[model samples]
Target: MSSLSKLAYYLLHNHSRIAANLVEQGIKEMNIKIPDEEKDHAVCVYETFFQFMGDSLEQETNEIPSKLIEWSKKNAEGQIFSGGKISEIIIRYPVTRKIFADLSTQWAEEFSLTNKESIKILQKMNAMLDVSEVETVFAFEKLTKQMKKDYQKELDTLSNPIVPLKEGIAVLPLVGTIDSYRVNHLMEKVIPEIAHLNLNYVIVDFSGVQTFDETTASYLQQIGSVLRLLGIRTILTGISPQLAQIAVAIGAEFHDVTSYTNVKQALENI
Candidate 1:
């Protein structure tokens, strides 16, 4: 066999040991701890990576293996699900790269491979690792964004809950600072929930609201109009003077809506 083929054969045969050593050296150098259960999985992933590297060296191509790309994505997802940061996963790459470089040099000397052949192995290893890093980061970012969107959807559901007070009465409490997103959530989600409840009165209490602006006034007016259209009497409570001023400034009329000092007053009168 050619020197390059022999070196590739050696690497392929000893990948498991090389992977274990890489992980051990990485953990020691980086001062990071991996759980016992995860350690085996980590070693397996690295072993596959080394095997792919060996394959690349034999093929004399810099193209990353599709299996390695898939594995990198899975690793990124695992990190997110395990409550670990992407940075934690990425931080070990440098240590791993150094270990691979050292191993490549040592293996070249043992196999009596020429300098060009050794450099070719190093080049393939670098290319595979670079692509793996990119894939991992991209997957991590995409998952994180999706997670934030889901969390916001859950928060919106909680913030605009329609709590039933009696058979035909419910309270729609608006909590936290009002934003365009929350306003849209109210129109899209809360309105449908209110309609399904078959309620006669909906007291949109703003006692917990921390923001009063022209846009907020407009959204509040729109909600009141929608409830009126559904034949539900809308009661406005906890409208501070600042809120009242903004409502007037924005020309948002609540003439048809009843006003109350608080939920207790609205509940008692309704």
Candidate 2:
């Protein structure tokens, strides 16, 4: 192995011990009031960066840094699941990089390396640190997107509910305003539920829904069509005058679907 590679390997092999000590030093240097769990996370973060740096030097390849950046994005996601914030690493990286860079300089001095060789190692260390900053931010954004989707799914489940009125009869009372997301989720959820329940008729009560746009009127038409194909009849109730006007404005015709004034009226008819 090359001399630089050997040095890097030696540093990596002692990384855990060095990181444990560095955590205390870093806390003092940063002067941040962090919890015990955060201290442990700091140790882990330091170890990961040390391992990445060691591999960069050991492999002597231009691609390892890029690969490490990709891997850190996934790593950041996992860390979020474990209650570690991306901001923690972002806030602490400057100090951590300085400590590691100083350690590398000390190593260079030990090897009797000249000024030019020392500068090259410092340059590589700074570049890796830069890559880390970008990757951590990207990972945080990925986590945010995942969280948003999960929240939307939960909202979909909450807003769309199928309550069985009797054998082969059900009521779907939609709450709040209609958006494209809720409309899509309703079709996705209600279609399978109707088939599974063997429902012949469903009373769609929109009394709680405050408003809907032209797109929502289109979705209602589509839902009626899908229910007809599945051999389940949909009876829509609670068409306020404003909603009726919107339906007319949008030129939506629901000739195939039945309409009622309210759920009670629809139930009485059945």
Candidate 1 lDDT over 1-270, as tens digits, reads 888788778779999998898888888989878787667877888788878777876876566667778878987999888898999889878887898799879978898878987887777787788998999999999998999999999998877888999999999888888888899898988898889999999998988887766787778778888888999989989988877777788787888788998999999997
Summing lDDT over every window of 10 consecutive residues in candidate 1, give the lowest-scoring window: 56-65
Clashing pairs in 1: none
Off by over 4 Å in 2: 1-18, 35-41, 44-75, 82-85, 98-115
Q: What value does the lDDT take at residue 253 in candidate 2?
A: 88
In candidate 2, what are the lDDT values of residues 1-270, reduced to their tens digit?
A: 656776677768987887788888888899977778757765776677667667777766544445457656865786678777777768777897888678768878776656776776777777777787888888888887898999888887887889999988999998998888888888888778877889889999988888888888888888888888889899999988887887888887877778999999998998
Q: Model 1 misses residue 171 by how many Å? A: 1.1
- Candidate lDDT (C-alpha), each: 0.85, 0.79
| TM-score for each of the candidates | 0.86, 0.71
